[model samples]
Target: MENELLGKFKLVVGMEIHFHLKTEKKMFCSCCADIWEKEPNTVVCPVCLGLPGALPVPNIDAVKKTQMMGLALDCSLNMKSRFDRKHYFYPDLPKGYQISQYKQPLCIDGKLKLESGTVVDIERVHLEEDVAKSFHEEGKTLVDFNKSGIPLVEIVTRPCFRNIPDTVEYCKQIQLMVKYLGIGEADMEKGQMRLEVNISLRTSEQERKDELPKYKVEVKNINSFKFVEKAIQSEIIRQRELLENGITPMQENRGFKEGSMKTVPQRSKEEAKDYRYFPEPDIPPMEFTPEYIKDLKTNLPPTPYMIIDKLEKEIGLSRNNAKTMVEKLGPSYISKFEKLLRMGADPIQTSNLLLNKKEYRNVSEEEIIEVIKNTKTAYSKMEENELNAVIKKVLANNLKAVEDFKKGKESSVMYLVGEAMRMTSGKNKPDPIQLKQKILDMLDSDAN
Candidate 1:
C-alpha cells in the first residue's frame, strides 16, 4: 500500500539561477561593480540611476565573461545577439524596465550532467543588469543603487528535475564551474548567486506519458540550498493535499520562510506577455565571428568534471571521495593536493586529512607530510583492543552524544572521538582519523 501511494505522483522541478559576473564595472555603465561593503548609492551613475537623458553603454568585459560562461556550460554561442528591455516595476528597479536579453539570448541549448548521471538541459543563458538593493523599515522603504548596474547572468533550465538531490547537485556543479572559470564568487549568503525553483506534481500516468502539470508554483529568491530543499518538499506536500481534495493548485509566486520552513503565498505569477520584452534601442546588436568564438573556447580552463576524472584515474581515489574533495575544497586547493603527493604523502591519508581537518589546509606541505608520518606511527603502535575499549567507554559514558550521532549529527561523532582521545594520553594516543571511523562503525553496528 505504501509503495502504491508513493508511486502515485512524481515531482517536476526546473531552476532559474541568477549569478553576478565578477567584472570591474557594471553591465551598461562605467560604475564600479564591487558594491560589497559600500555605502548606499555611492556607486550610482546616471546610467544606473535611470535619470533623464541617461544612455547605457554596454560593458565589453561583461559580455566576454558571459560568453566565457556559456562556453564553460557547453552552450552554443550565437553569432549575433542583442539586448532587450524587460518591463517590470518595483521600488528597487528605478527604471520602468530592466535591460535584459529575451528573444535572442547569448547562449542556448547547454547542459549540465550531475554526478548521479542525470543530465539537466539548459534552455538559455542570458545577460542582464542587477537592480538596486531595497530595505524596508518602519512604514518606509530605502533604496541603494550600489548594486544597481552590476553584471548579471541568468541561466534557465528545462523542467527536467524529478528529485531534490539531482537539483541541488546541479546547483553545486554550477558554483564549482564559476569558481574554476573565475566568473563569480557564487556565495549565496552575500547574494552573489540566487536560486529560483518552478515546481509541480504530476500523476504517474502523466509522468509515463512525458507530460507536465498545468500549474507550477515558483519559489523565488532562495539564498541557501537547505532552504531550496525544504521549500520543494513543503510545496510538494501542499500541492499533493490540494490534489487529494479534488482542487488544482493555483499558479503563483511564493516565498520560503526560513523560520517555519514553509512556502507562503506572494502573488500571481507573470507570463511572457506580462513582461513585454523588446530589443534595447540604445545598444547595438552584438556580433561574434567564428574565429572569436573559437578563441574563447580554446582559452577555456578545465572544468570540475575533468578534475574529478584526474583524481579517480591518476590519484587512485574513489569516485565519491574525489568528488567530495573537489566540491568542498574547491578549485583553489587542487594544487595543494597535488603538491602534497609530490612531497611523498600517502594519497588516502592526505585526502582524509584535508577533507576532515580544516586546520590541516593552512599548514605548509612539509608540516603536513610530517604529521601524516607521525599519525601512522602512533596508529601502528596502538593495540586494536585497547583502542576499541576506549571508544566503547566513551560511547557508554556519553549516552546523549551517542544518540545524537545516530540521529545523523555527524559532528556528534567527533565529540565522542575527542572524549576517547582525552581518555588515552601521549604514547597510547590513537589516530584521530582512525578513531572517528571506528566510532562510526561501532555506532552503525549498535543501530543494526
Candidate 2:
C-alpha cells in the first residue's frame, strides 16, 4: 500500500529535530534542570521567567553537548559560535524573543547513513534555549516558565528523503544517535525529542522539469514518528488531489490532526526575515579549542550502525534480525545477550527466545546460560526409548493436534512438540531437531 502511494509522487522530507541537552541547570540561570514530577511552577527562577533586571548566562555543558553531537554526525565544528534573538509573539515566549543561533551555529555539514544505505545530509546543528510550555483550557491559556530556559540543540537536515518509511527511519536513526551520545534521553513521550517535518512532492520521473514542484508544507511539533509518516502520507495525497483539480498547492504551516489523520493549515510559510534575527549583545562569542573537540570524540559512545555491524560480523547473526533485536533490547540489553552467546548457547535458539517470542521478559544472561546447560544435560541423560515414551504420552494427550498433523496441517506439529516439551517440564531429553523427528515417526506409526 505504501509503495503504491509512493509511485504517484516523489516525497521530499526534511527534519528539524530539537533535542534537550542533559544539563544540571537551565541554559541561562541557576534553576535546576531536573523536573522530577514537581509542582508546575516550582522550577522557575528570575532569568527563566524573563523578569526585569534578569541576565542570561550560557551553560558550558550544553555547549559541549552541541559540539559532541556535531562531531558524531561528521559535521564541521565551528570554533566560534554566537547567539541571536529570534523575534516571535506567543504566550510561550516569555522573553518575547528566543535566544537562538543564526549567523554562526555550533556545527555544520554533517551526514547520517540509514540502514538502507541511504545517506542524509545535515544542513546545520545549532544551540538554543528552549521555550516554556503552554497549557490551554476553557479558551484560556497558561504558561509555565519551568522549561523556558532549558538548553536545546536543533539539527536541521537537507530535504533529500524519498518516502514516508524513509522519513520514519531517519527520525529513529537520529534518536538512536542522540541517545547513544548520552547527551539526552531523546524520549518523544517526555518532549525531549521534538520533530518538525517539511514535505514537498515532485514528479516520480527524474527528467521531467517542465513545471516546478509544489511548495513545501511544514508540519510543526510532531512528537511521534508514526504521526510523522501519517502526516507526510496525508499531505502527499492532499497535494496530488489539489494538482489534479487544477489548483496549486500552497506553502504554509499545517498541524497534524491526530484523531482525524488530516492536516489543517496554521499559517503561511514564514521567511527568516520575518523572524527579525539579530545578534544578542548580552552574551559574547563562544569558542572551543581543538583539544576540546578531540577529548569529546574520545568519550563518544558506539552508534547504532556500529553496533549492528558488530552483531552481524562477530556474533554471526543476519542483518535484519540483528537490527530488530538491537532496537527492542537496546544496546546494553544486547550486550548481555552477546555475553550469553559466548557462554555456549545455540545462536538461533537464543535469538528466537529473545526476538521472536513475546512471553519472555527481564531475561538475564545467567538464566539463559543455565537453561541451555540444563537442557543439554537432560537430553544426554535420557535414553532413546524414554524420549520415545514421552512423545507418545504427549500425542495421546493432544489427540486433536495429532489428528491435525496426520491431516497434513504443518502448523499443528509445533503445538504438539510444544505440548511434549511442556509435559516433560522442558526436559523432553532431545535436541529440537531430534524431538521433531521422533514426533513425526510416532505420527507415522499411528497412521499404520
Candidate 3:
C-alpha cells in the first residue's frame, strides 16, 4: 500500500453537473417553473410545448443567477452571449431540439477548491433547458412535459481530479455553493441536480500528454456523491483490468448499480455531431455592460471553501468543526459566529454553544451575541451543587454503569458525564476533564 497504491496510475476525471435554477418561470416561456408542484402538462405552454409560431421569451432572472454563480466561482463573465439549438429527437423533447449555450456561453475560465487542497478547473458554466420527466411503467415509457422547459445551469469541470476523494469533495463544494446562493436546493435525490462523470486512467504523465485517452466512460445521472465515488473507483478497477488483458475500453455510457456498487454499461456514447447543434433562432444574443458584471461580483456571497478555510486557519478551529459550522450554520452563518467571537466569546466554546444547541437554530446575529454575552455573566461554569445533582441523576439512571466503573471499567464515568450532559439538554455541558474526575470521586465515595 505504498503511496496508497495511487502512485502507479493517475485518476483523471471531468464532471458535468446540471443544476436546476430557481427562477419562477420556465427558461423560454411563462409557464410555471416549479417542476415538482403541478400536475403533468399543467405547467406547459405554447412556447414550451413547441407549438408552431409560439416563440420563446427568456427569463431574465435565470441569466442573472448564472452570472452570480460565475462570480462565486471566480469565472470570467462574458459581455456577449447567445443560445444555440441542439438537435435531437425524443418523445420528451416536443421541439426535437434543445436550446442551450454552445459557442458563446455566459461564463468561462473558473476554478473550485476541494477540501483536500486540490483545485479543479472549470471549463464553463452555461445555460440550458431541462428535459421532461420520463417514467417507465408496465413496460411502457411515459413523458411529462411539465418539467421540459425549466432553466438549468450546466457546470463543466476540467479533467483535473486525481483521486476519488477529491472528486467527491469538489462535487460537494459546488453543491454547497449553489445552495448558499439560493439558486436551488441542489438535492440530487429530488432530481434537482444531476452529475455526469468522465473517467480515465493513465500510467504515466508523458503518455497522457501524448494522447490522454480519447475513449472515456461516462457515468450519468449519479444521484449522490457517495455513489459517484463508488462508481469512479469501480470504473478505474475495470479499466485497469481491461488494460492488463490487452483490451481497449470503449467509450460508452455506464450506470452505477446500487446493490453491487458496480458500473453497468448503458449505451454507446454520442459524439458532438450526433446532436446536430445550431444557433437557437428563438432567442437573441445577449450583451452585458461592465457595470453589470461588477455589481454581480460585489453582491456575490463568500464561497463555502473560503468560509471553512477561514474558520480553520484564522480562528484555530479543527477542519471538522469548520466544516460543521458551514454545514449547520450555512455559508453565511460563519460570519455571525465570527461577530460573537469579536464581542468577547471564546472561539471553541462559542462554536460548541451555538452549534450544539437544539433550541438556538437560525437565530439572528444580535440574538446570538446577546445570548453569548448573557451566558458569560450568568454562569462561568456549572454550579458545583447543580453539577453534583446532574451527575447523581445520571448515575441513578444507569446503575449497571456505576458498578462497572467500580469494577475497574474507568471509561464508564465519562459515559455517565455524557448522560448528564444529555439530561441537561446540552445547555450546561461541562468540560469532560472536570466532569470525569468528579464522577470518579462519586463512584469512590459510594464504594467506601
Candidate 4:
C-alpha cells in the first residue's frame, strides 16, 4: 500500500555506523584484538574487565585508522581530540560508562556520494571503545567481555537521506571502503560492524526544507543491510499512522525484532545530557601535528571507486560485473588479477572463475594461468574437421536452437556451443568464443 502521508510529510534519516578497527590490541588495554574465535570472557584483561585500579591507554594505531577513514570521506581531521566517558548501565557494559568522544571528535564535515548521485553529509567521525557481547537465551541474559574494549570508529551522518535505496547504497559503499582501506573487514554477520538509524517525519509541507521534526525514532544494533531497509520502512509506516491520528510519535530507541520486519521500542532515547559525558581521567588527550596527519593521508590506499573504475575501463568488465568482482575478491587481490592479465589470461574468463568457481578464488596466479593454458590446449587439440563434425552434430540435435539463431536470436548460438561441448570429451571441446564463430560460419554456409 502507498504511504498514507507520502506527499503530506517528508522523511528525514541519518545513520550512526560503528565498526571495529582491525587493530592488534584492545583500545584501552594490551589484550589481543583477535578474539573472534576465542572462548567467551577468556580474552578479558583487567582494563577491559573494568577491574579496580586498572587504567586505560589509547591505541595509537586505532586512532590513525579512524583518521584514515575520515580522510577517505573528505573530512577535516582535528589535531586535538580526546575520549570522554559516556555513562550508561547495561549487562553488556562491564564499565558503568563507555569511553567515547563527545565534543572533540577526530574528524568532521565529510560527505559520501551514493551511486545515484545524492550526497549524504557526515557530521562527525569519532573514536570509542566497544561494549561486550550480549546473548539472550530463554528468559535470561548472558554477557561476554571478550568484545569489550575493542576499538570502534563511529561515523555520524546528517539527516540527509530521503529514501531507503540511497541509504542502503551508502552503507554498502562504506563496507567496501573499509575493506579497501584494510582498516576492518566490516563483516556484519561476524559483529565487526553495526548500524543504527535515526529517522523522523516532518508533519507539515510548510516546514522549512532544513527543519527537523519535533521527535525522532532511533532503531539500534541492526546487523544486516536488508534489516536496515526493512526497519526503516516499517518505522516510517508506524510513525505515519501515529501522526495521521493527530498523535506525535515518541522519541525512543527501538530494535528490529528477530525473524520479523517490525520494530519494537527499546527505551526512551537519551539525550547527550543523560550520558553525563566527561573527559577520561586515565588516558591523556591525543594530539598530532599537521605533518603527521599529512603523512598518513599521503600513504592511504586507493578507494573502492578507483578500483571499480579500473576494472571497468581498463579491464573491459561491465559496471555491474566490475562491482561484483571488487566486492567478492576485495581490493587486496587486485595484484593477483593483474598478474593473470599479464600472463595473457582473458579478463572476462578470469572474473567468471573468481566469482563462480569457488576453488579458483584461492588458487595461485600460476595455477590460474595453467588452467587457462590447458583450456586453450584442449581446444587446439581438436582438429578443425573433427570440431566441424561435432558442431554439425550439435546443430542436428538442437534444430530449434539453430532455427532461433538463424532468426536472429544470437543468444541461441551459446546453447548450441554447450551442446557441442557436451558431444566431445575432455580434450576435444573448443573454447566457447572460438566454437561460436565456427558454428556461425557453418550455419552461413548451409544458408548459402
Model 3 ranges off by over 4 Å: 1-8, 205-211, 310-319, 331-346, 362-429, 432-448
| Backbone collision tally, model 2 | 0
Output the worst ten-in-a-row residue range by lDDT, candidate 4.
373-382
Total clashes in model 1, counting residue pairs 3 or more apart in sequence or in different chains: 0
- lDDT by residue (1-448, candidate 2, tens digit) is 5556655666677889998988999898999997756678899988888887788999988998888889889899888999999998889886789999999999999998886678888999999989989999999998877888989999999887876767888889888878767788888888888999998777756416534365789999999988998898888788878766777689899999999988889988898999999998889998889888888888877787888788778876666556766777676667667777788777655765675444543666778766555644334444666777888888888889987876548688788777777656443445665466557656765765
In candidate 1, how many Å is residue 220 off? Answer: 0.6
Q: Write the per-residue lDDT of candidate 3 for residues 261-287, one digit (tens) a residue.
A: 999999789998898888887688999
TM-score of 3: 0.80
Which ten contiguous residues of candidate 2 have the minimum total lDDT? 373-382
Error of 1 at 221 (Å): 0.7
Order of quality (lDDT):
1, 4, 3, 2
Question: The CA-based lDDT of model 3 is what?
Answer: 0.81
Stronger candidate by lDDT (2 vs 4): 4
The predicted structure with the larger lDDT, 3 or 4, is 4
Candidate 2 local Cα displacement, residue 119, angstroms: 0.7
Q: lDDT values of the candidates?
A: 0.87, 0.80, 0.81, 0.86
lDDT score for candidate 1 against the true structure: 0.87
User: Could you tell me how far off, in angstroms, the CA of residue 285 lies in candidate 2 after the best superposition?
Assistant: 0.9
